[model samples]
Target chain A: MAVKLFYEALHDGLEEEMQRNKDVLVIGEDVGHYGGSYKVTKGLHEQFGDLRVLDTPICENSFTGMAIGAAMVGLRPVIEGMNMGFLLLAFNQIANNAGMLRYTSGGQFKIPIVIRGPGGVGRQLGAEHSQRLEGYFNNVPGLKIVHTSTVYNAKGLLKSAIRDDNPVLFFEHVLLYNLKEEIPDEEYYVPLDKADVVRSGKDITILTYGRMRYHCLDAVKTLVANDIDPEVIDLISLKPLDMETIVASVKKTHRVIIVEEDMKSGGIGAEVAASIIEQCFDYLDAPVIRLAGKDVPVPYNGRMEETVIPYPKDIVRAVEDMLALRV
Target chain B: MVQEQLAPTKYDPIDRQEALMLYRDIVLGRTFEDMCAQMYYRGKMFGFVHLYNGQEAVSTGFIKQLRPDDYVTSTYRDHVHALSKGVPPRAVMAELFGKATGCSKGRGGSMHLFSAEHNLLGGFAFIGEGIPIALGAAFAAKYRGTDQVSVCFFGDGTTNNGQFFECLNMAVLWKLPILFVVENNLWSIGMQHHRASSVTDIYRKADAFDMPGYLVDGMDTLECRQAAIKAIKRARAGEGPTLLECSTYRFRGHSLADPDELRDPKEKEFWRKQDPIPKLTKFIQEQGLASAAELKLIEQEIRAEVEDAVQFGEDSPEPPVDELYRFQFAEDE
Candidate 1:
């Protein structure tokens, strides 16, 4: 076993996949020699040459569309965005081309393309740079969405994503990149649509994924001290949502609190809450609650940032509110 | 005398055999579109049908010069491109009818025909969307050590889209083997050329990429073929990309539902006179290449071929309802 950071694991996974498959290529701005803005693709260009690891111009929409086209013609392309904020320029390609190609083409074409970039707030990054777009992509059909919380899962999940024959939105949290974890020293792949149970409990279900997953676990630890046993479910894949896991969690706990870093209104948490209400309404002991970031631009100040984003205290308060409902 | 030299009176010097094939394919596309328009009005096929009526010469002239392995991506007005790229007439007609036997298994209607066998990549409904995709196809072909070029066909209206400029820049910068064909059909929907663009000339738009751009008479099938052959050859020779602006017209409206009363009767008259099939027929006869009776026999053969295709589509079974969820997610179990 080796101690790997989320970025390292992602790098290793991509490098191995590219070396194994000649059809696999990497395309993005600063992805070649500079090794990406986040350094996730560091040293790849030197190792693979310019052909396998390409440095594209600052044209996200065109390059993203190009990646989809390459994928259609038997190439597996991994398009890296400098940040999720920059992905706005590429929304047209992703939503219209990548998300609709397979269906529009009646399955004549397959897009084995992965668009990777860091999402969620970190440090003092201003409003534009700190947005979370998982909700936006998760709402789009014909795409697989994945967010990883640890190095092992990131690497495994990325490998699985590369091998997947569908277009995928691979969201990597900026804060989780440097966080180290033990990764198995062997080739492994994780299934795309299965949820991972972080901690099992019967009192309340804390549903979340990505960086929020670690925070939810921390909140669970705190809740345990208060004699509140919360079941923490890490939703690995947002699209192709494994409602079976959420429904089962609600059945066991009878109360749910969805914690997400994205804003509350029309967020992914709202969708999850709606699904629970629609499917698991009768079984719920208390109404399903959501703990998410406030609906506003993520502030640049560290003090305001901590208060603006969802934290363990918010999770604890939401759980206490559910308990009050039971009384 | 200037016209003779510029247009090249001798088709032999430019490869006459290839020119003949192009003419035949252009006729085939024109016949197919004419039949579709007639059938569409009779309610034999449903939904939106963007007829490539006057644009036949551009598709036929362009696609004839491409290798079978070369990729062709086109816009919503794409029947001519699909036909020229060798997609079966039966499958295309079935697609227009929204039947399972259609090119895209009935999922895609007229605007989204796709065939991997013939390398007809797809026809994107969104304007200018396929340009970048064609560039990527070119990138892949080059990466695979092949000399195949990818042809991206779009209307003059798509020139305003950012995707078009962005793809053109990338294609030139990367030296991608891409041929951007602008089928300037005089108008986009009811909107005319002047209202929609700063410069009505489509070739000027390609100048921004520092690439070679040519403006040709789209109604002249031989002119279109000659231009496309030069562009495709340059691209295949690793000379990067070129843009060919075919000044064409769509005799039908944007879709089957559109009634083109917005166009001037005089402009329409001017284009009608330049209709490619008749022009090519006249050229073939005057050159004594084919007799009038022989050409009439060819037209009869084309009509029968189209009739058989229509019958084949009408008789084909509809896709089952269970197939609704099919091809939705490619990665899942």
Candidate 2:
């Protein structure tokens, strides 16, 4: 196993996929000679040349739509959003063209494309720059959303996204770029619709994904010290929600707490909580609580933004409050 | 240097064989669409049946100039374009009827049409959506070193869209082989082109992107053909993309649902006089391309084909209810 940063693992995964398939192309603004805005695509343009690594103008909607067209005729295009927030301009193409084209076209055109970039509650990043579009796009059908929380899974999940026959939206947290972990030397791919059981415990099922997964771990340290052993499950797949894994975990723990960076209104936690109630209603010892960000535009101020986003302490408090409930 | 081809005139250069083929295709489109109007009124087809009544010349003129392997994308008014691209009339009719035998397997009605074999990408209902998709097909052609030129067909309303400018810029920057054909029929539903656009001259907008733009006589098939031939030649030779503004008009309202009353009756009367079908028929006869009897025979044959297509649609079954969830994901063949 070799230690790799989260961004470096993502780069390695994209490079390997491109090398394995000549049809795979990397296209976005600053993705070519500039080496991508996040430096995740560094050294790729030099290796693949302009044909495979293309630098598109900042027309997000058209370029994304163009990539979908290319995918139809036998090309796998990976579109890197300079920032995921900027992709709101491309929501039309992503939803109307990419998301619904195959089904509306009667499956004649198979869109094998991956739209990936870094976006989440950032460290002092402006409201415009910091966006959790995963929630915005989760309601859209025909899209597979995968958010990678660690270095090992970032590489594995990305390769799987590139090879998917349908459109896959790969969400990477901006603040977790430097997180490092050792990964196997051989090429490996993680399933796009599975959750990672980070830690096993009998007390409760702590559900989280992306950046919040690490924050949940921070709270877990205190919980373990206080004799509260909460089971942790990282939901890598945001769209399908991995009902098999989530339901089983809920059945065992009988208590659920969801922590996420997305806003509270119409967020991933709401969907998960609803699914749990619908599927595992009798297994619960307490009502499922969600420690999601406040439903508002993210603030740029360090302290103000922290107020909206849930930290490790908030998760610890929520678990303690839930534990005190006898019903 | 001496001018090799004559300037735009009543009739441009076209051989007898090519002229007959164009006449036949135009007739098929007009006849098929007229049948669609009948079916739409009688409730055989549903949901925004946009008839390509007077736009036959544009579809035939441009598509007839392309190789079968080349790709084409169209807007909601797409049945004529699909027919010109060699999608079978029966299959297209079945699709409009929402039957399983449709080219899109009954999933896509009038607003969406697709055929992988013929490479008709789709019929996008939303304006300005399919241009970038066509640009991608052209990009793939350049990436694979194929001489295939991708063509996108949209109405004058689509010209006002941001995607129009965006795609034109990329097509020039990447030097992709594509043709942005705007069938400027002068109205986007009830919105008049003059009222909606700052520059009603859509072809002139191509100057912003530094690509060649032409204002062609869309009511004349030979003239439209001459313009298409040049653009296709430039694209095939890897020069770059071209924008062609074909000044045409739709004889019917925007869709069957729309009442034919928005435009000044005078405007409709004037365009009706310049209808592409009669113009082509006169040019072919006067130029000694085809005799009156021969043209009549061709029209008769196309009518039978269109009638048989209606029967095929009527006989075809609706997609099974049990498989409603099918085609949403990629299923292994």
Candidate 3:
């Protein structure tokens, strides 16, 4: 086993997939010689040449659509979104073309395409640059959404996303790129649409994924010190959501706290909370609580930005509040 | 000087077999579209029906130049384009009827028709969506070191879409083998092309991409075929993409729903005088390429073919309820 950074694992996954299939290619702005804005694709162009590792202009709409077209044919194109915020420019292509191509074509075509990029608030990147737009794509059918919280899952999940016959939206937390984790050297693939329960506990269930998984884990440690054992669930697949695991956890824990880095209103946490209530409402000791980013654009000021998104303290507080509620 | 330049050029000499084939294709398209309109009006077809009535020459002319493996993408006004690309008339008609045997398995109605066998990539409903797709198809062909060229057929309104310019820039930059055919029918729904665009001449926009551009009389099949042949040849030679703007007009409303009150009667009359079906027929007879009786017999055969397609569509079964969930994802193991 070798320890790798989250971004390095991503690069390794892409490199291995490309090596395995000649039809696999990477296309996006600065993905070739520039090695991507995040450098996750560093040296891929040199290794695979220009045809496999393409650098496109700043036309997300056309390039995204082009990747869809390429996917319809024999190629499996992985389009880099630069940042999840930039995906808004190609929203039509992703939602209209990629999401609907297989159904619209009567299953005649398979779009084995992945649109991967860093998302969620990072550093002091202002409103437009920092966004966790998973909610926007989660509502769209015919799309599989994957957000990895660890370097190990990043590599394994990304490999699966690259191989999936359906269009996949892989969102990586910008802050987690350098986070290190031990990954097995042997070939392995993480199955899509399955949730991984990272921590086992009995009192309260903490549901989170992406960057917030780390925050929830941090909060779990504090909760443990305070004599509260919270089960932490990492929701890797956002779309074909692993609600079965969540419901079973809710049945066991009775109380739940959901954490997300996106805006609180219409957030993915709201969907998870709703699903929990609908599935195991009678088993719940208290109402499910959500700790998400404040309903506002991520501000430029470091202090304000830090306050806008959820922190470990917020998760701990939400769990405390949920547990304290009398039912 | 402008008047002298605008004067009609001498017609290119076409042999009897080629002339008859071209005439038959145009007549078939015209006949097929007319049947579609009649069926749509009689309530045999549902949803938005956009007829390619007066634009037969553009599709027939351009598609004739493409090899069987060459890809073609088109806009919502795609019935004639699909026909020209070799999608069976029965399948196209069945698609309009939303039958399971249709090209898109009844999932896509009027606006979306696709056939992998014929390499008719799709008929995209969004105005300029097909442009980038065609570019990608060309990119795939070039990447595989194949000489297959892709053709994208869109209306004048599509030129204004950001994807159109973006695709042009990339197509030229990558030297992709693509031919963008702009069917400038002058109306995007009720909006006129000149009113929506900064420059009225759409072909000239190709110069911005550093690619060759040509404006052809879309009412003339011969002119369109010649221009398309040149563009296709250049693309096959790896000279990169070419933009061909075919100046044509739609005889029908934007869709069956429109009243078509936006166009001037005088302008309509002028274009009616240039109707390509009769124009080709006149040329065929004037050159003694095909006898009047022979042309009439061909027209009769086309009418029978169209009637047979209608029967096929009507006889086809509706998709079962369980089939509704299928085809959302590929069944590949």
lDDT of 2 at B107: 85
Q: Regarding lDDT, does 2 or 3 come out ahead?
A: 2
Candidate 3, residues B115-188, lDDT tens digits: the string is 88888889999989988888889999988899999999999998999999999999989999999999999999
Query: Comparing candidate 2 with candidate 3, which one achieves the higher DockQ?
Result: 2
Docking class of 2: medium
CA displacement after TM-score superposition, residue A87 of candidate 1 (Å): 1.8
Overall local distance difference test of candidate 2: 0.92
Error of 3 at A77 (Å): 0.5
Query: What ordering of candidates by TM-score runs from best to worst?
Result: 2, 3, 1
Q: Which regions in candidate 1 have their CA more than 4 angstroms from the true location?
A: A301-303, B1-20, B331-333
User: Which residue runs does candidate 3 get wrong by more than 4 Å?
Assistant: B1-13
- DockQ, per model, reads 0.69, 0.78, 0.67
**Highest DockQ: which candidate?**
2
Docking class of 1: medium
Residue runs of model 2 more than 4 Å from their true location after superposition: B1-6, B10-13
In model 3, state the lDDT of residue A152.
90
Residue pairs clashing, model 1: none
